[model samples]
Target: MLGPGAADVAFEVNGHPASVHVPPHHTLLDALRDELGLTGAKRVCDEGTCGACTVLVDGRPTYSCMTLAVACEGRSIETVEGLAHDGQLDPVQQAFIATDAYQCGFCTPGQIMSVVALLRANKAPTAEDVHRAVAGNLCRCGAYPGIVEAALRAARARRR
Candidate 1:
């Protein structure tokens, strides 16, 4: 449960602790995009089918659009922008860019996050595993093949 007041939503985002005034009905996705200016996580198919609003909560991918901001009071949230470090992109991100894994880019962040989680779980996943890992994230541009190649490339890179 959230603390008292309509203006009392406080939580940590991307390692930064923050508090904001939001309506009780607002979702974590809305609060992140509209209030916190974190727009990397897309808001689409608000029912949670599209996986566009996927973000890392406690290092696990979550559908933010369906999650209440109050539920993240003490959880660590990570957006797509959080994947880079010291102005350098993470290997998965670089591989995505290199392999043209994104088309319109609307679903790229969520795809990357899902792949990130997948790679974390299986360092040497088979091609079928790659396909299954990203099946949940839908790309309107039909970049599935490129997405799989990107994940494979990142996986191979990590082994070096």
Candidate 2:
């Protein structure tokens, strides 16, 4: 049986099955970065206040820092590292680069993930939709305008 503080969590990450041993207290962010060596989710606030550790859990944006690893059992997780396929970057990523959506690059991953989720749900998102999606993500460099432009640009690109 699993111990009081540990458990074997099984989940799907980036379309791959993952089974890892983790402590009950371990956050998904820790599991992703430490155990799996997936560092796309940065450890910033570590309290969910900042969206640096944002990832997609079951198609919805989630703050991995606040989500327990054990609680993620049987769930599907998608990190920024998984956004690309066959050597092609996700459209959101391309748009972020094209629009200069980031500076210092600390919050770019989270912002991109949020926009990815938004674009998945709404292929054509308005400025308000983009704002609402990334509302929780904080860009210390004051790159909100570029971020919004990137999201809109990605949405339009997806339509082509």
C-alpha RMSD by candidate, in order: 1.7, 1.0
Which lDDT values do the candidates have, in the order given? 0.88, 0.94
Look at candidate 2 and give me any clashing residue pairs.
none
TM-score of each: 0.92, 0.97
What lDDT, from 0 to 1, does candidate 2 have?
0.94
Error of 2 at 104 (Å): 0.7
Q: Count the backbone clashes (under 3 Å) in each candidate.
A: 0, 0
What is candidate 2's lDDT per residue for 1-160, written digit by digit as tens? 4556777899999999998889888899999999999999999998889999999999999999999999999999999999999999999999999999988999999999999999999998999999999999999999999999999999999999
The runs of at least 3 residues in candidate 2 whose Cα sits more than 4 Å from the true structure, single-residue gaps closed, are none
TM accuracy, model 1: 0.92
lDDT of 1 by residue, 22-80 (tens): 76678899889988999999988999889999998888888999998877777788888
